[model samples]
Target chain A: MKYGIAYFPSKQIQDEVNSYRKRYDSHYALIPPHLTLKESFTADDAEIESLIPELKKIANETDPFNITINKVSSFAPISNTIYLKINPSPELQTLFDKLHSGKFSDDADHPFVPHITLAQDLVDQEYSDVFGSLKMKKYDLGDEVDRFQLLYQLDNGSWTVYETFVFGKEFV
Target chain B: MKYGIAYFPSKQIQDEVNSYRKRYDSHYALIPPHLTLKESFTADDAEIESLIPELKKIANETDPFNITINKVSSFAPISNTIYLKINPSPELQTLFDKLHSGKFSDDADHPFVPHITLAQDLVDQEYSDVFGSLKMKKYDLGDEVDRFQLLYQLDNGSWTVYETFVFGKEFV
Candidate 1:
């Protein structure tokens, strides 16, 4: 099965993002609004089962951190994906590095750029038109993320939760 | 620093437990309602940081599981811990075993008992009085848990979140 790791924002943030996504995003229904932490990778059941203990330790060491979205941005030239740009934090970078290290494989096509996609897979005309107006609008939103989910894609191309991990110390 | 692993239930469950905890549990204000997965262990910052990658692998392999609390129970001779009993599940057992195995230490004072403490640290007279009444009332509460937290204790005796691991796969 194919799985990916991501941070799902609070419902308030999801609702706000959906308002724009409903009109512009082709993948609005495929999954909920989220910030991708690790890009998707392939693994079988046994391969994944063996990795759970290590994942718990990663979560144990990670402290929950805040991400602020002050502006809308786009992956132009590279792709027509427009997103709510998450302000970078050291904690986020550390998590990205951990996911790509050790037993896990690192096969990222792009360098880590923290974001929650609001609109994606658009034609060039729509992309330009949407990105033009949306970039000017203000979006000062933020949330403390304590957990990230492991997700798998369904036969219908929709995604569902496979597991979740919260950021914090477990020794107490 | 002293650290431990635990599962914190939903707000509704927390509130319900707190209703009893406020009056009975001496350590109520020290922390919220939780199910302890790994008992306390000592580790410095560097030692904990080194374990993050392995923790991530653990969270990746596990799947989100459910716990049901249909009755009130207590740890009488073991200790004066009054709790809402969580019926045993294979997933819980598997997780407990993983936390105890490999890089982590296993120094459990008691065998694994899945529960959320509603009351603790009571005198014998108080313990009997409380358990007698609370045990009679039914509590058919349940929640789907996808994540667990690592916590550390503060100087003032309260515990704070250090990290959290949600059970799931990361490869997609």
Candidate 2:
């Protein structure tokens, strides 16, 4: 009954990111490398089915946008989530804004900080091991955000895509 | 060819806002009191036509969110636009993001700051007058955002709605 919206990276990039996530995060096997839009909300099958038309409309109108992953960063000294910092971009922000508005609205109380999580909830040794290895690691991961997906988690603590909405056609 | 996405307020609020805008803004009569999502973009008729389905989808998926106008503010020193300040709401931000991300993407290069413009390009005295009057006046103008619209401007500098998209049914 709970669902969220997100953008999954390409296979090549996902594989590389997941490899790191597996070592650092316990939930790595439960999910994939993706950026979340709407975090989580409860909904039934009928409700989700009704939303397809609207989701399609949003996808159709949206143009593909490119995301650039500049470097690895951490929410340290406060939170334990290590993430890939997304470069400042107008397009990404715009896309983020839309996903949270309208019928897809959710409780996003915190300020929008655009990042893709690489690892989280690490202890001292684990954090040191991951950060030590990743501190010197610089990434220039780039990809076109052509589609955003709706995903849901089962009782078994696994996430799966409910639907994938592609950006609408570009007007010539 | 040039278009903007916006949300129109109630007639009562629109009238009140427009009264102030007309006195301080030269272009007040040119448009109504509305919050803009996508500022402006050039598109041919055919291109816009093709975007209807996508726009509809977005509109359908979006549930209407209420907007609360807490006070008046200005974009001063940097810009000369005076407007009503929108209280920070996740719904508004989400709606704004969806509008710009889909096929309806436009040339909004600036950061997304949600405000309803009352006056712009005012003379020094005019700016001072409007700012002085508004700074003392508190506002609590609130309205439900049932729908968002796509609007186009005419050659004579007037505007008209090309389409109106309503939010999907809300589950009880």
Name the 10 consecutive residues with the lowest summed lDDT in model 2 chain A. Answer: A163-172
Q: How accurate is candidate 1 locally (lDDT)?
A: 0.78
Candidates in order, TM-scores: namely 0.52, 0.49
| Residue-wise C-alpha lDDT for candidate 1, range A1-172, written one tens digit per residue | 7788888776567777878887888876566678898888888879887665666678878888888889999998888999999998889999998989888888877789999898888999999999999999998898998877776654445454555665553321
The stretch of ten residues in a row with the least summed lDDT in candidate 1 chain B is B163-172
lDDT by residue for model 1 over B43-151, one digit each (tens)?
A: 8879887766667678878889888989999988889999999999999999898888888887776789988998888999999999999989987888988877776
Q: All candidates' lDDT scores?
A: 0.78, 0.73
lDDT of 2 by residue, A92-126 (tens): 78777776778766478786777888889899788
Fnat for every candidate: 0.00, 0.00
Q: What DockQ, on C-alphas, does every prediction get?
A: 0.02, 0.01
Candidate 1 structure, TM-score to reference:
0.52
